[model samples]
Target: MTGTPRPRTVLLTGASGVVGRSILREPTALRLLAATHSAPAPEADGRRIRCDLTADRLGLEKEEYTALAGEVDAVIHSAGLTEWGLPAERYRPINIEGTRRVIEFARHAGATVHFMSTAFVAALAETAPVALSEGNMCRNYISSKWEAERLLRDSGIPHTVFRPTNLVGDSATGWTSKGQIVQLMSDWICRGRAPFLPAHAGIRMDFVPQDLLSKAVLRAIEQDVSEGEFWVTYGAEAMDMDASLRVLAKHAAYLGRDLTIPPVVDPDTLTAEQLAGLRPMVRNYVAVLRDVSEVTRCSGGVLPSSMPELRTRFGVPLVDDATAYLRSLEYASAHLS
Candidate 1:
């Protein structure tokens, strides 16, 4: 990795985010500038800069913006609103417009960008088994990212786009800066709170360990990958619904608790009476789970993957998927709960 010429100083936007923290933890020799909103980042001791994505020049003074532009030749564009279920308008100012600002800054800095996009964008595909409505939980968020990717593509800037599925934890130690949606949803299921698994048939549950994603990005940076699109997902190698439930059962045994694996229910089959029978909160949770399952099922029954490319091109280790997930669950049980 050291033999290749890489960027001297790299600007890391969203330095306080989960992916950003994982990147900070990864071994790297490049000097990194942590561009954050307001929260102090790991690099806050020296290279952290506060910025507003909605503001021009990231809300930095003219001199500071110029100084930053001069210092970096590469950017890890990881910043954006990732929360699901928000209105379309809520995502515009941050995810879409903020990316536009980042593109402007990159243009000024003459820096190549490595963007972090979500695999959930597949949900909006015309080939999806289930059609997604405007009110679908993450439709707007996914669309926003898709638009941002389009912006970078049209800008004629040298950039790489990585569409990662839901991230879990480190492959070895299962460490995460915070619990991601994968962990939270797994917890809810394993704790026997999920009345039934609301998912599409044959849809694989794809969740990649965060560190692998971090390694992929850093290696792409180190190798000076000029232009490419990669899906950092497990695809067919990912666990199926039955396998996922078995992992939960294993996790329960590890915790000295017995768990009943919930029956899988296709949301489309549920009648109004059955839907009304669920408590309001459970109904909402089920709806979210169902929508997420549909999202996972978008590109046919399985999501598209770039795992083989990641390993061959970037030297990412192919750790067992279920093992990584169990380690994550164990870590959350011990540390993050």
Candidate 2:
């Protein structure tokens, strides 16, 4: 009788990132080769490889690169800059060129690739039916991701692109990477410094816990086919602005603080004085909120229908929106301060 077949060895980039670590936590039959740019790599089960995606050959030596290429059956490219305010020039090397290098490496290794991208790649439209499907126009950070996707598609390597929306903390412990824009907003709200927000009732905000996203990624790797685009999101089940604030208010009540819900201001109708009332940091989000509101107004707040089917097929759990928001607030309260 044949012995049990050995588990396929997969190389994972961005092993130090939020989603990367989450993927590392899940038990899987695959042997992981985790790559990191920093000195001290994650203390996990994988064979840690020090490599930079932006560097030539991912900064790996000739022998090391050849050995890795021979061993890896698949590659998951999750490492990249996600900061919003950075210029396109700054993001080009890491998000765009880095992806090109990843595809190149995958081709050499004869391995399939899984690319992590954001749902904002759909971009925001000014008119109705803002359906977030493939091939939408976006700019800045999102544009970098779009360009990377294009490179992957044209690379002639077997690949799947996953577009997840706003990622919250862990579903259970609410642990997450600090310095996200959501953390800033939560901080302002908890401090009672934010008196008003530019939002609309119809605006829908999608959030996926890192745990669920990681699981989905792993499933995609294990059940890999030639190619597909998966939108890892809650779709129409996502919470609206008012509902999200209510959840935050509930968390505030649990903490024994009577928080006043901020009034929503329409971005288009805001007077100069009204804009001046917002905190300097919060003011930057005005345009973002307006764009989202416009998308909601046009699309009736509907995400793609295939999202649910994909989530189910991948065994991703349906996270409770209120719990996810509360856990995020709790983590933000303790750490963001």
Candidate 3:
């Protein structure tokens, strides 16, 4: 019988992101070559390479980039512009072309690729369904990510695509940097701007904590799954936006006696002028609240179904949403404002 292959090497981009940080915490036998466009990170175990993905050669010449690429067995492309309000040109350079560069580097280096994508790629408009899956069409950021995915697939490099939902983690510890979405939610829950009614409540956003997302990506790396798509999430049943908010409320109550998170508010009740004058904190809270509520109301109930292949084939563990949600809240409260 043949023995299992030795642990392979990995070149991980976005070493500081919500999912990327989680992946870095666990001890893996693989040789990790972690790269980031951000400022140099504190010294750690892995081989660290600093490169801006938007650069023509990803800030490395063909020979140097190829040399570094040849040293790794797989590439997990997590670096990209994730801002919703970013211009298309801005997003295209990093998210699109940068992805293409990863694919090229992986292919030339004869390494496998893991593409970090978003479920938001399923739709951009409010009419898009909330519970999108692999088969769903691309819209908004989903559209650009879909374009990136297509390029990777066409590159003929062996690849695994991960489409994750909202990410939850602690920001104070630098475990998870607060994204725009999370920041908005934090504002609402901390400042008491969320609505009270079910209809007016934020949409049922599917969320996966950093740990789960990291695990799924690790699983994809360890196993030679078919080159296709997979959704890394806590599962459909776990994505209860309102219930998650309640947990946030509980956390606030625990942190400060004066803090009281309100129930969901009806959008029709708030005048434009009233919402306009809100502090940055309050505005973010209202925006996310309204956005989620409006989208969820339009999309109907339930998150996208889980991909059983991720578990039955690769043995990835399922995470408890309430537990993850609460942990995230506690961590954020202790660290970030």
Candidate 4:
């Protein structure tokens, strides 16, 4: 880190979620109060406490809540419903109102918030080549995070936003607590399950090692940084479609599985009738992929990024994209299969 991590106590919300779990994996000097959803986290690597983000004082007793506010200097707000393709309303309770609750607590505690937002919000940029469709799977999720960021800003609470793209695994060992989208989709596609890859031409496939984000956040806390928006993504350094597909092919070979790499189909060229003709299951997956393409295209085919800053400032490892992606695929095949 920048210095011997300045000791500071932090209330880490969503301590049981993927991002939260990843954060706990990193070594840090900050004192942590891990707020979880239900059952206690035996391996939270910090003190664990059950919490309800939608409730007043996060469901803690008033006296206890006041005490908690006095105990922490900052909050790492990582908890949220991150699943895509859900109805817009499904996001309101957690992504919106839960954030509202966090804001209330931050205000009371005079604590700075280090909010985990999404890089997909780049789709809302003014230079976007196309509008993000309401039908897009990620639209609702991205919109919810955008609203949450605005809430923090309007609340006048001291905060910093870390907007990360899709996460894969650790940069070195490629270990993830659970399977992520890249692994799931790579497995299916490598097995020749996909009829065609519906992705926008020239769009970079941006996925980051989960640990990079964790390191950045911890460094921010150690340094007592109370403001700034960081995009923890590889912009120009990200792999293009061809390289992504090549990795799939390599993985298939490694597994001794026959692979017929699917043809890349432009999302715009695919007719509705053609999409409708696939089997119900295939159609669903294809539609989601196509919609995700719409998300990338809307962001001018490249999401906003802050990789250089992250590396220079926070010492996030500069693992090459293809190398990390391949390692993640190999790790999945070996363990997660």
- TM-score of model number 4: 0.96
Off by over 4 Å in 2: 1-3, 39-43, 124-138, 177-179, 276-279, 285-300
Clashes of 1: 0
lDDT digits (tens) for residues 228-297 of candidate 3: 6777654456556567667766776776745554645676586778777877766655554555454434
lDDT of 1 by residue, 1-337 (tens): 3687654888888999999888888888777888888676763444688888999998999999999999888989999999999989999999989999999999999999999998887777666766676667989899999999999999999999999999999999999989988888888877888888888888898889999999999999888897999999999999998888888999989988789888998877988888789999788778888878878766676888999999999999989999999999999999998
Candidate 1 global TM-score: 0.95
The candidate with the higher lDDT, 2 or 4, is: 4
| Per-residue lDDT of model 4, residues 1-337, tens digit only | 3767546889998887778888888898888889999745544765677789878778899998999888789999999999898998999889999999998988888999999999888897677778898678898899999999999989888999999988998899888877888888888898889999999889999999899999999998888899999998898888999888888889899999889888999989999899889999889888877887788788878888999999988988889988888888888888898
Candidate 2, residues 1-337, lDDT tens digits: the string is 9999878888989888877877888888888888887834354575899878779999999899989999998998989988765667989999999999898899999999999987766554334354432322234777799899989988888998888877888888887764455656666675676657776556677777777878887887788655888877777788877678888788788778889887887755878787787777666656555555544444455444345766668887777866887887788777766
lDDT of each: 0.88, 0.75, 0.66, 0.88
Model 3 CA lDDT for position 231:
70
Q: For candidate 1, what's the RMSD? A: 2.5
TM-score of each: 0.95, 0.88, 0.81, 0.96
